[model samples]
Structures are given as C-alpha cells and as structure tokens.
Target: MRSPLRTLVPLALWLLCLPALAQDYVPSRDAWSHASPSEAGFDPARLAAAVDWARANGEQAPADLRDALMASFGPREPDYRILGPVGTRGPANGMILRGGRIVAEWGDTARPEMTFSVAKSTLSVVAGLAYDDGLLPEPDQRVSMQVSGPWFEGAHNGAITWTHLLHQTSDWSGALWDIHDWADRPDGDDPANRVLHAPGTHYKYNDVRVNLLALALLELQREPAPQVFKRRVMDPIGASSTWRWEGYENSWITLDGLRMQSVSGGGHFGGGMVINTRDLARLGLLMQRDGEWNGQRLLSSDWIARALVPSRVKSDYGYLWWLNTGRTAIPAAPERAFWAAGFGGNHVYIDREHDLVIVTRWTPDLAGVVTRVLEALEQP
Candidate 1:
C-alpha cells in the first residue's frame, strides 16, 4: 500500500507533462494572453523604450503616395491595379509576443489594413500545405503536369517548376490578371519581352508571376487558397477572423466550371493581405513555433526548415520570406532571424533563437525599429 500523497504525486506529474498543460500561455479565440516584459524575461525599461520608439516611427500614407509611385513608374499597370483610389490607412501599429504571450503592442493592432508583400509569405505557407497534402509531387515537379492546357501548355511556361515559382526564379513569362510579366516593373534600360534565362536559373519579383502561382495553387488544391489556409492553418493556430486576402479587380479564373479570383502576392498594384497586427503576431508566433500551436502540429517542422533555406539565386530570400543571411536584411537582428516583409513597412518577424515574434504595420523605419526592439532582449 503506497502512501496516498505518493500516488497523487505521480498523477500530478503526468498532467504537467501533457502538451496542453505544458503550455504557459495560449490565447482564447478572441483575445490574446498577456504577459509583462519582466514576466517574459524582457527588460521592462528597455521594452518601454522600444514601444515609445514605435510611436514615433509609425506609418501613414503620404498624400502623394500614389502620385510618387506613378511618377516613378511612368504609368500604372492598369490590369494589375486593384481599382479606385487608395483607402485611408490605419495607424502605424504593432504587437510583440514572447513565448506566445503578448509582451506589448502599439497603435491599433486590432484594425485591419493592407499588408502588401507579406501576403507572399502567406502564399508560401499555402504552397507548403499543398505539398504536405501530396497534391504537389515535389518542389522540382513541373507545374505544367498539374495545370491543364493554355498558360502552361507552351514550352517556356511548361518548363517552370513549383520550386522555381516559390523561389521567384521560375522566370515564367506570362500576362496574368491582365498584366504582362515583362511590363509590371520593366527594366528601364534593358527590357526583355522574352525570358532570356532558362527556368529555375533566374529570379524576378514579378507580381503577375506570383498571381500565376496563386492560380496554380488554387488549381492544385481544387479549391480557393483561403479555404485551405483557413481550414489547415488559421483555425488551428487561433488566428483572428478579421483577416482577408484580396486579388486584383480582373483576376477571376474559371477552374472545373467554378470561377475563382486569384489573389495578389503583394499590395504593389494593390489588393493583397489585409490583417490586423495582433493576427499578424499570431502568424509570426506560429512560424516561430515551427507551425505548431499548443499541442497540435499545423505544419511539419521539416516544411518550415525547407521553406527558410536560402534560394540559390537570392541569398537574402527564402520561399517568399526574407532571410537575414549575412545579416543583410536586418543588420542588427540575428542572421538566423527571418521576416515576411511588405511595402509601407508592414512586417512579421520571427526569431526562434530569442523566442520572440514581432508584427509591425505601417511602420516607416524597419531597420531602425528592429535594431531598437532587439535591444530589449537579454542577449544569449
């Protein structure tokens, strides 16, 4: 007959080791779990300085933002444009999470706003989900085999692989969502209508090509990309319901008799991810956790590892995510840290080494903000 306290102790230890019980912080569906900087191993005074710095460097759309863009680019790519004048911007705001607990936030972190190129990272994850589901054969598999006749039927486009598309090295030339690949950000002095490099050998950040990848994903999933992300990624990770990914005005495509709009990769021509900073922080947290939330694995750590591996062509870029190889992307941040960066200073940064996640929207000084924020942590 064991002592009553001894028997109870074993049961208590078992409960403590369970995954859900092991978690120190997990949010309710509608709200985040909060923690003080000191509680989360951050220097309270230094964290305050970081928050104050954000207040002084928040983002606002310039009255001449469009005028400046049009002036610089000569003319708008009408087909790629999202239609109408720009919407009023939300405040320059963000949230910081340490060990999945909210450490601090500034601005209106709940208000949704355009997140530009960060949408590309969202697209990258969707691609991961498809690959995980076996809908895609492999990174090297030719997309032509999956997509039917028309765009990918020709030799130049048919040569493109899923890896090529993910790396932005496909150099797949095409007019998608009505904008020609060569015309989106045409090289002024050396414009090449035809793709000069073979597929997988060159890199180009063409929004049209990104849209093409979206279409390909939509086809591969046999459903909308949003549906896949919602069912597989967001719902499990406890992300907010206020997020939306938008496509261009004319990006609709008919697949299997159902018409679907292909979402844009960025807010460049307009119409991309519109998400609040809190939700953005949630996403960063998930990635920081290697696509796990609480006890469940939303994505395999293997996929996350492969996705962050630098492309052969672009050392500073991973699958739609910006890597800090050689500390080029963020000089102050660790080389292992990576970010999903967007125009207007929108960003979702992940640093597993420091167990930190950061989301910044409408921020102006990315490098300056990152440098100051990283200073709050007790260095390893």
Candidate 2:
C-alpha cells in the first residue's frame, strides 16, 4: 500500500555487471525527436482516438487535493516557501515517444507545472547517480552508515537503509521542513496520532519521511540535490533546464560551510518538482533505454533493474516508481511496464516491450491512454 533494513552489506557485491555501452540518442527536435505513427507500427487514427478520450473525458482531481493540505498545514505550511497556489494543475497536456522519438503530443507540453510525486523518480535518478559515483557504499547499507550528524541520529532512524528509503517502507519517523510524518494521510482520523513504527517494518507514503530521505542524501552528498541531479543525470540526458526542484525554506542547512537546500521527495508540502511534459518525456526516454540516453550510460541498468522490481510491501509499487502489478495501477500495461506517477494524473509510462514512452498530465484516462497506445501499436 506504499512505497528497508540495515546491514554493513558489502559494496562490490551490490554492483551488477551492466552492459558497458548504452547506445546514445540525440533528439531530432530540440524538445524531442519525432517519428510518424506508422514508423512505430502504430495506427495514427487509433492513437488520436486515445488522446481524444483523455482530452474529452479528462478531469482535474478537484480542490480537495489542496483542501486536505490546507487543513493539515494551516492555510499553507509556513516552511513551504517556494511553492505554488494550493492545488494548482495546468491545462491537460501529453506526449508519446516511440523508439525515443515523439509520435504524438497535445496541449501545452512546454509549460512547467507541479508534478507532485514524480519528483521521487527524479530523486531515484539522483540516487542512481550517487551509486554510479560510488558515494553510496551499498544499497542495503544503512543510511546511518553513510550519513553523519544529528540529522540521522537515534537507533530507530539508524536502522533504516537506502533500500528502505527508496521503497517508501523505511517508516522513518521525524519532522522535516515542518511537515510531520503522521500528519499526512494518517491511517485513521487522529491528526496527532502517535503510533510510530520501527524503521523498515511498515509501508507508508509519508512525504515528511521522504523529505528525510532527501535531507539524508543531501548530507551524504554535501551538496544541493538539485545541482547534483542537474550535472549528473539531467544535463547528460539533455533534459530542459527550465524544470526546477523545490525545497522548503526551513529545510536549508549549511553543509561544509556552504548553504544548501534539501529538496523534498514530492509536492505534498508544496515544494517538489515543477517540470514540463517534454522534460518528463525525456526522462521517460532515458528510462526506456534502460538508463541509457542514446548510448552513454547515464544511469546503470543495475540501478534501473532494482528500481523497477516490486518492493516487499507493495506489489504495484517499485522503488519510488509505480509498477503494473496485480492488475492495478494500469491493467492495460504489461507487467514489465512501469510508470512514474504523480498526483493529479501525471504519468510517465515506460513500456519497454514496445519501446514506448508516454507522459500525461492532469488526465483522468490512464487506462484509455495505455489501451489506445497499445491498440495503435497493434494495428495494421
């Protein structure tokens, strides 16, 4: 129902042998590459029909998405300094990529907007970068083992591992950026509920805890997470620079005598990822190529493999990313097909079987999107 353990796990053993060369791809279009639907063996009309379904019947999840936040955070959370209006969603937009080329698109694909939890996927990539640089000693190694200082102190928090944080199962109890782990989506009505569990024992989608993960990673890297991501992952992948990852004002900490911001895992507290669909599509394309953009290995297939595999607590969720499992999330998608989903219907679907990457924003028809895209690829 959500998204780790501690051991001095050996580092080298965790590194799986990946293909040395991941073919590099260049974008034909500045925004993205383009291809005819027929080039990908897809029916143009069927694809349009699917896009039409989304545009015609799509919905905004309503202000309750923010109403709950406002209620929980008091009009607006004070620490959420770099956020947007409560419950903001842009006009519907989407893009389809096949063979790393755009097959179709609609709406204002370039307008950046809040992407909610998809920031977790972005964070996942940063984690991948950390591993690639050998900063993370081991995936199963305790976060406490890597990060030092009062931030990750305490036996309960010390027991949590990187794998647990990635899977949203760490159950790390703490308040970061003024957002309490228990204040968000409590299993019951009590907002002040104090039933905290041990680390890695439960699965809960707590942004406060996720933010803790961001902070811990920040301390471990001793740099702003966004800059590291930009230099290591996004720039190499040629993603748009307009996209921004937000962090709370209070989340700022001076590291190595330099001030830095620790970005949150998602927009639950208002500060998260604000990115355009084209940028998101680029991200999907990178993932579709199995952590390769064209051919340069920006992300290791080893990390991607672990990131996509289902976690122990949630069958339909992988490490921060969502998986198509148990016929939930997207029954129309293949089991191997995974997606980076955000609140308000934002999705970056990775259909490796079809070499397809689809990104949709603020649409209610994920099933229609998947079904239509798959149907088009099947047509004569």
The number of the candidate with the highest lDDT is 1
Instruction: For residues 1-380, write the lDDT of model 2, one tens digit per residue.
Output: 21112221321222121122112445733555567777656788888898887776655545345654555455433333334333466568899876667788999898888888899988988888788789986888998888887656788778889989998988776666666666566556564656767766678887877788788888777788889988877787777879898887677888889988889788776778988898898888888878776567888988899888888787887789888887676776777888888777788989866667899998856777888788876531
Q: What local distance difference test score does each model get?
A: 0.78, 0.76
Off by over 4 Å in 1: 1-24, 63-80, 83-86, 190-195
Off by over 4 Å in 2: 1-25, 28-31, 60-88, 189-193
TM-score, each model?
0.88, 0.86
TM-score of 1: 0.88
Model 1 weakest lDDT span, ten residues long: 78-87
Error of 1 at 71 (Å): 5.6
Best by TM-score: 1
| Pairs of colliding residues, candidate 1 | none
